[model samples]
Target: MNIIIWNCRGVLKPSFKKRVGDLVQNHNPAILVVMETRVGGDKAREITNLLPFDGAIHTNTIGYAGGLWVLWNTDRVEIALLSKTEQEIHTEVKVRLTNLSWILSAVYASPRNAERQVLWENLMSVADLHNMPWVIAGDFNEPLLSEDKFGGRAVSVNRSLLFKECLDKCNMLDIGFAGPRFTWSNRREVQALIQERIDRFFVNPSWCVMYPNAKITHLTRCHSDHCPVLLEMQPRIQNGRSRPFRF
Candidate 1:
């Protein structure tokens, strides 16, 4: 199944919703995880009700700051909630067609640099129980290497080390991407434009064994500063061959 992970910045804008609808029409993602929705309660329902997905579990935004929403096509996948918090929606997702089940987490790390360590710890706690394959996607808010960024001030080595350390502790590997290198930008002029691969997916070895050909694609930035990213579990065919990866 294909899954989409994006930081929409905010979804209250009709223009933004129109772009999302366009994506829905073209990609037809089985599951969608949106970060930073910035809407809650009746206002959130007023908006997401328009989506094509039949099932959804979303955390309300806090004073226009942060929100996380996970939407799925019930016919394609069965979702059983595991645990939830403002930063994560952890669940067991089973594909109806293949009878394959695994752990999926749509997590949004805190934007504040100082508070992110706690978020990493929370994720590690989840990773500790490693019975099934797991795919974690979201805006991690930290980069693993200097090369993951573009046209910005250099990323601190300390920050990168911290993030890398956490991923190591959890036995996570960065999934490969097929499109643009960066998923977020400042939308400024040439000298001022800053881009970074802040949003992505990380999988454990079990995931590689399950779908060895899986690949991620980065969609163009539409109305939001962040671009939509899709994880193609059943890899797209090219030249009558599936992309190969080493576990």
Candidate 2:
């Protein structure tokens, strides 16, 4: 199955639906995570209902800032909400008609360093609790390595160090990607442009063993400053059924 994660910036734009439809048509993701929705309440619910998904769960936007929506089709997989904060959503995903299961965390980290520290701490807590095959992906808003940014002030040492420490402690490894190295850009003139590979997928070792053929791609950026990331896994045949996930 395919899982798509995108920092769409806002879902209220006129082209939002079309962009989403294109994504669905092109990728056919079983699970889709939209970050920085910037809309909430009844309006958010109404918009989500119009999407071509069977079910969804969301975190409301705080004022005009962050919001997150995790949408899925029940026929593809069964997703059970585990926990959530404004910065993250944890879920257990079981591929339909198969015994395969795993944990998926969709993250939309804050741009502020202090708040990001809190996100790190919370993820550590999650790491301490679960030992399942796990995949954590989204817009971290902070580059994990110096090479992850270009034409911008260097990544902060203290912040990147903390982020590295969190990954070390959590035993999560970056799965890497195909396509463009950077997933986000400032969209400014070349002389003033800033780009970073802030969006990514990190998987625990067990997850690697489960879907050894899993691959990630950084799709071209369009409806948002950030690129929509697609994770595709090779299918595993059991009896006469195929488990696409092999989330």
Candidate 3:
């Protein structure tokens, strides 16, 4: 089944709404995961209603940070929000065609290294508990290597070795670079030269093996500094295709 993951920045803006509508019409994924929603309570509900499917939202108290959302086509999938903590939100959904359960962890890690460590630990714990086919996709806010950045002195403190190690321990595979290579930009002259693959998609081995045809799709940039990332997957087979009987 097709699944898309994007750090929408925030869906409250008019530009974002138009972009989202165009995206939904163009790709029509079975599942959609959004990070940094920046909307809470009633505003969150309003955003959900605007999407093409049924969804749930997790919002933070401080307004513009830590908010996440998952939207899925109600007709073909069943979704349940598994858990949510201060840093991340976990969701599990069953695809009707495959009968295989899929778990999605949409995250927004704080830029500070200390806070990120705590968040990484919490995410790892949840993954261990579930122990199923899953994907962790969002703006990690940390780059894996110096190659991931454009023109800045590789800040040793900024790299997320612990986070990368945690994924390795969990046996998840990074989906690798999809398009443009960079998801975030500084937008300033010299700083604009700074770009990195801070956003990524990691999947459990089981899911990758099961859906061998799955891929990540990079879409055009909207109003946000980050561009949207989509996961396109082939429909799961329930039974072997039948050959036509020749007359």
Query: 26-133, model 3: which lDDT tens digit per residue?
Result: 887877777777777787887788778775656463546767777778788888887776557788878887788878887777777788888788777876687788
RMSD of each candidate?
2.2, 4.9, 7.2
Q: Which model scores highest in lDDT? A: 2
> Which 10-residue span in candidate 1 carries the lowest summed lDDT?
238-247
Tens digits of per-residue lDDT for model 2, 157-226: 8888899888887788775677899999999999999999998898888998888778788998998999
Q: What are the clashing pairs of model 3?
A: none
* Tens digit per residue, CA lDDT, model 1, 88-145: 8899999999999899989888888777788778888888876689888899887667
The C-alpha TM-scores of every prediction are: 0.93, 0.93, 0.87
Judge candidate 2 at residue 84 and give its lDDT.
89
Clashes of 2: 1
TM-score, model 3 to reference = 0.87
Give the runs in model 3 whose Cα sits over 4 Å from its true position.
61-63, 155-158, 190-192, 235-247
Ranking by lDDT: 2, 1, 3
lDDT of 2: 0.87
